[model samples]
Target: MSRQHLASALILLAISVALLGALQLALVLPGSDVPAVLALFTIAACVYAAAGIFAWWRRPTNAMGMLITLGGFALLIAGLGNATVAPLEIVGAVFSTAIFAVIVHLLLAFPSGRLDSPSAAATVIGGYVVALPLQLPFVFASADSREFAVASTTQRIAGAAIMISAAAILTNRLVRAQPRTRRILLPLYSYGVIAVLAVPATSLVFTTLGVRGGVAMPVIQLIVLTGVPLAFTAGVLSGSFARTGEIIQLSEWLGASDSRRGPLTAALAHTLGDSSVQLAFRLDKSDSYVDEHGTPVKLHSDTRHRGQVAITTNEREIAVIGYDTQLTARDEDVRRAGQVVAIAIDRTRLANELIAAQRDVVASRARLVDAADQERFRIAQNLHDGIQVQLVLLALEAQQLANASDTPRNVSTRATELRKRIDAAAGDLRRLVHDVVPLALLQRGLVAAVEDLVDRMPIPTDLVTEHENPALTSTVENTAYFVIAEALANTVKHSGATSASVRIDSNPERVFLEVKDNGRGGAVAGKRGLGGLADRVDALGGHFSIDSVPANGTRLIVELPCG
Candidate 1:
């Protein structure tokens, strides 16, 4: 057994010894009601002691366990009240009221052992003063002594004061506690209410009815005492199961594959049974916090409605979980769930980071493709407006010189050759302009432009359209056309291809294009024009890949989103 269990075993042995001593004292006492009085003390002592031991064994860390243990010890000390020895009787009388103080302490500090606030501390302090210091003066007084009246009056005043304080504290706690916390505290509150009423009721009974009241007082005390410990134990058991059950359910929920349906805050709220729960992740680099979507969120104290708990890993705070303020009464439950919450928050942060990275890559690629497109447009415009116009003027001037009647035969022949050369240069410029930004692609569509391109190939080529062309955005059409053009060019230049086939297939969601060459196959992805083609496709949220086998042929595929 552990040291805690050993200590509990030792305490149980001491209680048993004290119970035997109380039994012996009852046998020796002279009064007719001695057995009944001793029975009340013995039963209270046995029940509270057993309850304390059980609590201590079950939850060693909770202050409730030690507080309950102390209550039981106080009852054992109270059992010394009827000892035959005068000194022992005086000691017992001085301390017998201490058990009532302990009960008040236990009720105020249920679930958690520490007195959490100034008001709670003051209440416990007052109970101790009334139960111990105020009762000291009555310790040595005999029942018939002149001082007995003063002692009795002081006892009634102190008892009434302690009971009133306990009632106020219990009422304040219940009023402020949340639904879940109030449920856990219900049993203890019931015990407090009964104790609050029973203390004064017993006094009134003894004062008004005399002998009959004396006959009923022990029975009343026994019932109240027995009920208090039982209620406290019941509350402890219920709270433990409720907390454990929530943790188990949360574990199972998080373990499933489709756990990403809701945000981290919703999952935590459901797990903690607090619908108002909010999660904020700490950004260590910025010394700030953000919600799960990465929007900045400021945290502040609002104890009336919400409570905050920090979640940490590796000794550093990773996030904060804000829950219902009423849960502050059971702060330990929140603390225990912190590890699971931290893991979930960390996972969400990583997923958000991955999405952000992909977004950045797509945006960067789009900017690159836009720059390339602008450069192509500028070159095409210059060829058509400046160089082609100048070439045409040169061709017209040479033709006019060649046709002049006053020109010599040699000069006319030279001018005719110069005109032919100028016309040829103009034709080359026109072809370059067409290659830079194909007019057909902009005016007609992807299919017509690709078909026009394949007809001009140096080797035999086939263009097949699997579906009638649907209207598409300019980016999609331009990207698909360029991907096919680059792949066919690469096949002609590097693959030593004699023939090639281009296929276009389309659906509502996306368009698929495939280019295959019947040539010596040695194609690599992200090489030569393939890399530029891949970038263009990626800019339009498309996929590009190359498959090649040495003996077979190269196949380039592009998939572009159309809708």
Candidate 2:
């Protein structure tokens, strides 16, 4: 509880105690002449009842609060009619009993963490009913005399039992509930103390008054009789109005719009500080989930928007902001305060996806650039290693022939050797053009083109495929052709094994091609021709991975996204 609330409670307590004590004294000592004391008690009871009712009617406020105020009024009336033990005394007695019953109910209703659970609700109600009859005898002692006294004392015991149970329930439940405030306990304790004091005080006042004036004017009795009822009614009205303000705030934040709704919402937000609020946004009111914090959270799913809507109301009337957050905080004040500070958080998840795509695009372009340069270098090397050497040998042979005799057999032999050299050069040129852009890729589909590569491989090989594919885009077909060519070349040059296998597969989402060789499996990607081939595949946005373990043959798998 805040200091102000605590102070108010203490003040009320002191006043009630003092007034009851003074009335008791006035009854014992005849010359005290304290009519003002009686009036003060009446006023106190009235005010207390009003405050109690006001508190009770507040939204989320317990019914027990109303009962406490009512109980006080009962005591107030009973004390006022000490001399005339007529309707006032009887009514006062009934009020006092009601006060006890209501106080018990309120204390039980005091929200303890899990103690306010449905099961606990039942237990609390049941406990109150069972313990109530024990106090019955204390209300009406020995019907023969019809006198009020502590002759039974059962009411006190019952009250004590209720206090203990309420305390135990509150302690156990509040720990789990993690309530934000301890303000409620004040009222419970206050009503208990007042009720206890009033009972004994009333007994003493009436008993002594019977001995004087043949019937003493019951100053305390008069106050208790009138004050308690009036106070209770006022309190209920005020508390209800306060609660209405709160509910209006919730509705506004919820974003409800009715003729009266908007005003109520605005008023509530103003009353509660810093509230992030959603006004009248419909939610399923059923669907719930466990949040990241492991809290069992529920969301209103019935609405069109399934997510939570929150509002933050600031000190400024016009600047109410909204956001998403939890609503488990028990203090209405804190919830209002949170509204003021909460900010709109933007999640750019879509931007992150674009960044990833850009990275892939850049990486693919770089690989294509490198592959082009590498292919040019390979063609140059082939000329130097094969065709150019053959040309040189032919030149040397021609010179020797010229220096030898001009005979038919020697001339014919030289001419035949010259033809062989020319043929070799023509073959090299054709091979170079084919490597640049295989014509087979255009005339035949990917499978046919790949089969041509397998046919050329020197090693024993098996080709397994179930081909049901659309006519691939030119770029896709070219990429596939080169991949198979590179795999075949690698197997021939490096595997040094008896067998190899090539498999092609496709699905709606992607195309998959794998080449496996039973050779010394240490074939790493990006080594020799294989690296250039892998780069070619990358330019087409396909993934390339080579699993080449020490004793296991290499498996080169490429997965290309088609969709």
Q: Of the candidates shown, which would achieve the greatest lDDT relative to the real structure?
A: 1
Task: Name the candidate that leads on TM-score.
Answer: 1
RMSD of each: 19.6, 17.9
lDDT of 2 by residue, 19-41 (tens): 65456335423543555655554
- Model 2 scores a C-alpha lDDT of 0.52
Clashes of each: 0, 64
Instruction: Kindly list the per-residue Cα lDDT of model 1 for residues 1-563, writing each as its tens digit.
Output: 44446577858765674666566456435664557667667667767766766665554434565676677767666666676767767767777778778888888777545676788888888888888887876776677877877877886787777677777777787899788777767766776667646756787777787655354676777678767776776665455633543554466556767645566676676556566677778766556777888666888667687788888888877888888765334666776666765677777766655555566787677767767788888889988999999999999999899999999999999999999999999999898888788989878888989989999899999998875677676667778888888888888788888899999999888999999998888788664478867867877678888889985889988898874
| Window of ten residues with lowest summed lDDT in model 2 | 343-352
Instruction: State residue 13's C-alpha deviation in candidate 2, in Å.
Output: 50
Superposed Cα deviation of residue 220, candidate 1 (Å): 24
TM-score of 1: 0.47
